[model samples]
Target: MPVYTHGGDIRTAQAAYGGEVLDFSANLNPLGMPDPVRQAAAQADCAPYPDPLCRDLRRAIAAHDGVGAEQVVCGNGAADLIFRLVFALKPKKALVTAPTFSEYEEALTCVGCEVTRYTLDQDRNFDLDEGFVDTIGPDVDLVFLCTPNNPTGRLIDQDLLESVVKRCGAVGAVLVVDECFLPLATGGPGLAPWLASHPNLVLLRAFTKSYAMAGLRLGYCLTANQDLRERLGKFAQPWSVSTPAQAAGVAALTCCPHWAAEGRGFVEGVRPGLAAGLTAAGCTVIPGQANYLLFRLPGVADLKERLLTRGVLIRSCANYHGLGPDWYRVCVKGEAENRRLLAALREVL
Candidate 1:
């Protein structure tokens, strides 16, 4: 059988460097999984199968966001939902920001969709410009915008996004916004507010990031367009979300305030500490509201191997569509962990 690998495969990294390694490559919540959510999984019944449609979890999320349950679609994870959305829509041509999440392109390609890239200028700190609306028009069927976008950790202007959505809607394009990292931003809401106005808009969210439940594989999509949700539901398999995942997701939604607040606080508190450390070590840390920070080492590629040898795993951005060798991204971790990573990186650099 042929084998394929995705970036941030820890087992592959572990094989290369034997030992428990701190994972900064993946932009996950560094505060770790919330205790209440973990506890909920333990009490959930595993004997019978989970709700095929994730009824309870959907209700919880809908109530939490003040949306109708019918407007919500739960999936195994955000990635699964993204894939289903792409498959259901079956866009012939899609537009995505370069250096964004890899899964978007992979999923689009699986549906025979051709994708176009809008590269973010490194000098501009990879911020999305109003030009995005210009690139997405009648020719495009899907438009993906990642706020506080991956790797770059830059956000698109909210008004600009709204305008882009309007343009996409006018041209019958589906506007998909990935707010997976939105919780990390200081002033932004999770794009839930705009769902009513833009019926063509689809907001992708997950308990995996802010709620620290990545392993639980809990994710959902919110849209005012009932038919899109129905199409996604039809394409999704029965019980795509497991029993424990449903329980954990409900717990996450109910207990979201505590966990989200704590994770945000941890990232806020550690941002300066990590930035200072990186700056001291002669790297330029880009400013952002996300839990992860992007830094350009004076010469990061030169030190990648040495950092790996030190049992420290970091995301080297050479593989990212628009990013170059000097770029790297790391999730904001706990205090001690960040300190340890900074120490290792200092030595490596």
Candidate 2:
């Protein structure tokens, strides 16, 4: 399989450019990791093997989400769960959104599944409207929807999402919703609440972005279907989540309940300034609700390299399907870092 191209590789850029690089490529929490979660991970006992079932971690996640522990299944990361779902279900026909996360396609292709894409229009800011419901027919055995979607950062409309659930249910199609970025997006209510009625819905979440636990690799899937959950667990390797990751996941939820709210506040406060700056620099910025912005500028395909020379790193959207070379995505970072990024863009753009 070809390796996937993703953001947050400061080490590689540093090696190539021979300098410190400010990474706006990864959409992590700008508030940084909570001290409690950090301390918990550091203090975690690595001597013994982690719990294979992730009992305590699942309980914590269930409590946090107001769902039963039976509905939750932990994984190495959200990507792991994505792959597990695809492998377990072995859906011959699957539907996904174009210019979204590549992992969906990667996992589906590995299983030799027939993948269909519902391409979102750039003119519509990549929003999923009512028309998307029509695409989820009886032929599609599985559907992948990423809300506050990657790269573009546009969210799926609530009514439209409901319609999708209804359509998928009518067709007996399983719907997997990627909500890894929902916690960071203001006014973004995740679809976990809909799990009770929609047994076909599988909600994917992670501590990687919202809790700044990317290195720890803690993620989970929530579903009301007990059979599907069991199938996912059977396909997954034993003890996929590490000791530190489990400890950190629990600490993040119990110790820092307000972390998600704080992150949203920080992103909302700084995103406007960052978007304005990027727009002022001659980039057509996509108004995104998540803690990131997607924009396109003249020569954007080469702009990532030019900015790298100035010790800065940003995600080039050229690899994403339905997006061209001119598109780029950047995290809404702290004020100082945001200022530095704008300054770098001013010089390079």
Candidate 3:
């Protein structure tokens, strides 16, 4: 069986199942891409070279994020930014949480940085706590955190986040908070308010999940430290963000203010029932506030494979750092998709 790596695995599913696949792996905007974003992408005159600096898009992102344009750095995606930051900082030692996104470890390892995992207790629902703050010391040079964390989707508490940020600042460790899923995350007042005070903080965000433009590959990071921003420029190649993606990003922020909010509200409305349905289907669903739900089915070792046979592709969280083969994460999609997924589970179970 092909390994279920990331979401939007329709082609892989088709090759294996030879049938239509309802993808619940990628946790994107349930409403799909906004029309304005599509239009902006379509209208992008790609004939000329892209603005290597991505001036206009950065400005728009700045306005939306309430940061100076100089503080913003655009990239193909958050993963791109991750690698770039890793290369730029070249930190000797770093700290990351377990059961979170894998890119941080991948990026850090690529640069030969020693990574220490501060494991989140899965029994406590994989939510970060105060003790994680202690992991940030003078010895640790970089830290990665995710709000509405991947695979598990539980949010970081604001106070806990502050402690982490403050602790990082005290030790001069650069804290990279990946808030890519924050817009869809309900009740998440993101840590943007701390950027002004803490120069060591980097808020990594992306338009892929929130704007439903995964194909466009639009992502950026916010930081107050001019040296860090300038260092990113030194490491990143020119035109790292393509023209159409740039246009789409600008449109996502400036042209469509409520687009993210719409997706957030829609996910908020649908996620509870989906969690309930998963629980009813004999899975221990981790109640999350983001656009996806993470659950565990104890007896179904090959649940992802079985679902693929039914033309349903849900993320197998087996590969996530602190998770196991029994765990899975599925996006909270629209009604028809959700219904088909539940029906497939009913049969496969």
Q: Which candidate has the top score in lDDT?
A: 2
Stronger candidate by TM-score (1 vs 2) = 2
Of 2 and 3, the candidate ahead on TM-score is 2
Model 3 regions lying over 4 Å from their true place: 1-4
Question: lDDT by residue for model 2 over 67-156, one digit each (tens)?
Answer: 999999999999999999999999999999888999999999999999998898989999887778888888899999998899888888
Per-residue accuracy of model 3 over 1-349 as CA lDDT, tens digit each: 8554777877878889987778888889999998999999999999999999899999998888887888889999999999999999999999999989998998999989999998888789988988898778899999999998997899999888888888999999999999999999998878777898999999999999989999999899999999999999898887889999999998889878788799999888888888888999999998898999999999677999998988899888888888889999999988777888999999998
User: Taking the candidates one at a time, how many backbone clashes does each contain?
Assistant: 0, 0, 0
RMSD of each: 1.8, 1.1, 1.5
Identify the runs in model 1 with alpha carbons over 4 angstroms from their true place: 1-8
lDDT of candidate model 1 versus the reference? 0.84
Better of 1 and 3 by lDDT: 3
User: Judged by lDDT against the true structure, how good is candidate 2?
Assistant: 0.92
Candidate 2 all-Cα RMSD = 1.1
lDDT of 1 by residue, 171-244 (tens): 99999899888876655766788788889999998888887777788888899998898899888988899999
Which residue pairs show backbone clashes in model 2?
A: none
User: Lowest summed-lDDT stretch of 10 residues in model 2?
Assistant: 1-10
* Alpha carbon RMSD to native, model 3: 1.5
**What TM-score would every model get versus the actual structure?**
0.95, 0.98, 0.97
